[model samples]
Target chain A: MSLLAKASAAHLAQLMGPLDSPAFDWLRTPETGGVMVRGRMGGAGAPFNLGEITVTRCALTLRAGGAVGHAYVQGRDKTHAQQAALVDALMQTDAAATIRTTVLEPLQKAAKDRNDSRARKAAATKVDFFTMVRGED
Target chain B: MYVAVKGGERAIDNAHAWLAEERRGDLGVAEMSLEQIREQLSLAVNRVMAEGSLYDADLAALAIKQSRGDLIEAIFLIRAYRTTLPRFGASLPVETEEMACDRRISATFKDLPGGQILGPTFDYTHRLLDFKLAAEGQGGAAAEAPASGAPLPHVTEFLNKEGLIQQEVASDETPPDLTREPLEFPANRPLRLQSLTRGDEGFVLSMAYSTQRGYARNHAFVGELRIGRCAVEMEVPELGFAVEIGEIELTECETVNQFQGSKTEPAQFTRGYGLVFGQAERKAISMALVDRALRWEELGEDNVGSPAQDEEFVLSHADNIQATGFLEHIKLPHYVDFQSELELVRKLRAEATEAMSEAAE
Candidate 1:
């Protein structure tokens, strides 16, 4: 996944906190719309339309470098999509290295930490069984 | 003659007002919080989530409050709200074998890999109502068991090893979504199961019961039933890998039915599967039975013309939202149609009198 794509909405929102708003033109204004969800039978079987879910998508081009970025996020959070698009555009420019270290790295670590904690909690509930050896057998 | 009734706006408004007042039921009592319903009346919230097909406990509780404890009404509210939301993507099929189960049991085996954990169930509870619960400050915390640390194995896997159960071939085809497209007749197993999972609990239970009473009877054994939370993952095409999206509570049931042997195939036990949102064992078990009954054609069994075996009948009427809408629409104005019926009856009566008079003359 692209660095911007890997960053979750929560992480991206936090990353955008200190950065000054860069001038950009809206290639596509953030719009809330429905997307059809499809599911495959047994995960590996024939696919079928599940239902429509709300999504917010936006596209923007950085005024200086003309780096275009697009983002789509689940639910109707328009600001999340806008900020995500900006991050996507920034990732393609000279600021890529700095952004990777400052934003992406921390976000990735947080996500990994969250996953590990959940796994630990679930692991606590795991059980193992063994059969008793029968003397008759 | 039936005349069209008009000017019901005032009456409708007054009725709504009365309902709101009744819902409050004396402002002297404290208003019920959504949190209370979510925590205390959790089973109702679970039922709403299962039938509604939306797994948000808070929203389900809110729906319960808004509907004045009418579960069907709460389910309808959730369904209506669900349609407006956009779907992002489908999650990877949940692995039930990896479930951190709160409840797990199998009738086929006495002791499985993971010992049967009964969890919180009303199975052993006495039918006598606990009047003390009605009084305030009478509630107490129940005992808790230490979490197990062993992974549970499926009972069907044991049969599979001995080549005694039918082999399920994995396919790459997509299943049809009942919510998006208008339901078509002669539906496949995936479509049938999907409908059954979100189907009305009472309706599905009755249909399953009918099968047990010799209507398309497929002697079923509860192979395994598990209720727990599973992680949801989604494939990111851009990233070229699937990532964990979230987790959801689910109830899964697998039933082994009667043996069947065909000309081309050997005799082996058939399987029926059901997976639903929340800890809904009854719904899941019923779903599995109905699922197995509907597999008559593929299993090379005779069509006994049973309601359980009828795919079109079961799928079409299973949804409570659709059933209630059609049932309740009778309250709407039908004067035009009723007037036409009245005119026809009057004309027929007049003709009969004229013919009688002519015969007398």
Candidate 2:
């Protein structure tokens, strides 16, 4: 669920590789909303309202199997919400293994690679701070 | 006094239509894409998100475009859009200690764990404008090195461990939301932080600067300023556990201040913290300074009568949307009120004339 939520909507749609004709019926139609994000004071203290982030959420049941699924993704991408919910529902069905290999694997790998590259770039900027000394000692 | 005057329906519609045309600027110029604004004009988007109190880069970019690059106006658009959203629920507080830092530096320490990384910063760049950029030229590539990806320890934590600095108390109580409830006097630290995070950058910066100029001056050191990304997570009732929904770039500043301890306890360093949306370092720094000034009372410091120390005054005027609404509303027609004032002046003049004549007679 976390990986799916973090995955880009376009990426998810591509990984989904086209939907079955009405693959899942909406238990609750996908909708956009806001979620007030909080942050702690001084990083370890009481929480405070930082601000709100747009969220899109939905619930659905698979057409083939009666497995119900729910998703809450960041941002106002309703289609992304539907795709995430679809993935959630499909994961519970007999196709769980196939979906995990195709969808979940790629998303996780991409996320890791992106994080690694960014960390590397940041690490490059770390100051070595070579110390220069006089012969007084 | 204001009077309702109707009917500029055609003019309003035409003005809007003209605005749409004006927004296009030159037909020859390629229309600006949201992606371009999000990427290139990221700082602008960051300010809008910070002030607008919403952290959606695409939406912020759209607001910037629609407002024609006016940040305050862009903020207004975002604030307007925020009201239309259905709030699902509040998320658990974000743990910034675990942030994947792109840039992290400390003014107090010469070197620390997760060494000072000056990510993409405008700090050392000469003020000279590069003409190559004007011609849309590409810059040189950046160098990359291996990273351990371990969480960088907070610089203040070092001071904290030795009891040289005051410790932050953890609380389970939920902080009040100013949007949900009206801001009242003697606001708590959490409320002040919230207001400061979303406060107009210019206003907050000025207030912070005033502190540096000796207004409620709190001797401050930038204990740490880090720009990075953190995961936002919320608990799923069905799953009965928290899950990461997304990630957001953040700038966190912690200012260690000189604390003259009260009679009850010995003196130790105090803290003023600032955390905001995106890599908005300037605002974060300023916020930390002002936060320290505002903590004067609780820290047992003197009430030095500074603007930053006055929470009601600062928070009340910090919102750009409210400030602009009140300021801009004056441009609206006040004909009826003006006419009444004119009549009163005329009446006074007539009375003066009658009194002079009677005195002469």
Candidate 3:
């Protein structure tokens, strides 16, 4: 669910390509609002409101007797929220394994790749003291 | 003292129309898309997000475009828009320890667990203008190496373990929101930190600079500075536990300030913190310094009587939108006030003229 929220809407939509969405009822229609972001003092102390970040959330019930799906995603993309909610509802049904293999697994891999690439880029800038060695070398 | 002086409707409309056309500017040169502004003018967007107290880059970019690149105006737009939206809830205190750091460095230490990653910095670059950027697609992929996934702990933590730095006990007490309540005197650390993080960049920078020049001097060392994305988690009514709703880029700065001690307690390295939206290291560092300066009383230091030390002064004036509103208000019609001043000066001048004639006689 966290990974789903973190995934870019475009990328998620791309990953969900050709998966036919079942008919569902909007339990709670997609709505955009602000969430006050809080941070701890010294990164480990008491909390303080930093600022607000925009979030779009939605809840839907699958008409085919599956569980209710709820999604809270970043930004104001209603379609993204709707898609996420559909995926959540679908995960509760017998289709859980299929959705996991089709959507979640690929997203997890993509996320891992992104994290690896970022870490790799940072590793490049590490100072190898041996490179700057003088007389001893 | 206040009266509506209306009757410039036509002229005002014309001015606005002209301003709109000016914002568009020479249509043939191709209009700047929001995407281009978001990517190219990112610093401007970051500044707006920081000061405006909002974290939507697309909206910030749009505000920049709408304001014709007037950052303060863009901030004002965001703030105004912010008030109209419903606040869903407050997020759990983000654990920056888990940040996927883009750049992390410790100036106090030569090297640490996380080696100094100078990710996309301009620190060593010459100030010469590169004409190539004036054209398109000058940027290329950055160099990369095999991942060395080492834990990057906060530099201050090591000092804490050795009792070399002051240990801050974590608290769960909810801090006051200035946006909801009016700022009161003798503000606490949480409130002060909140105000500083969102304070105007230029104003906070100047305050920080003053401290360096010996006004409420608090010798600050960059204990650790990290910029990266972190997940924002919130517990939903539907979901039993908190789940990540979003990831936001933040610049966190922890500064080791001048050691402080009371008669009862021993002197140890005090700390100041800054966590701001996006990769705004300059703003974050400035915020940290001012934050330390404001902590004089709490840290058992004497009253320095500096502008930065005055919580009321700094927090009240740190918001550029509020400051600019009051500052720019004078440009509007002051007709009645001016008329009274005009009459008083005229009468005084006439009286002086008569006295001069009498003296001459």
Q: Give the TM-score of candidate 1.
A: 0.78
Q: Candidate 1 lDDT, tens digit per residue, B24-92?
A: 888999999998999999889989987887766778899999899999999999899888665655655
lDDT of 3 by residue, B206-256 (tens): 999999899999899999999988999998878888999999999999999
Q: Which ten residues in a row have the lowest lDDT in candidate 3 chain B?
A: B257-266
Which candidate order results from sorting by TM-score in descending order? 2, 3, 1
Question: What is the i-RMS of every prediction?
Answer: 5.5, 0.7, 1.0
User: On DockQ, who's better, 2 or 3?
Assistant: 2
- In model 3, what is the error at residue A77, expressed in angstroms? 0.9
Task: State candidate 3's TM-score.
Answer: 0.95
Stretches of candidate 1 exceeding 4 Å from the true structure: A1-137, B1-6, B137-148, B237-240
Every model's TM-score: 0.78, 0.97, 0.95
lDDT of 1 at B335: 78
Q: Chain A TM-scores, one per candidate? A: 0.85, 0.94, 0.91
lDDT score of residue B132 within candidate 3 = 88
| CA-based DockQ, model 2 | 0.89
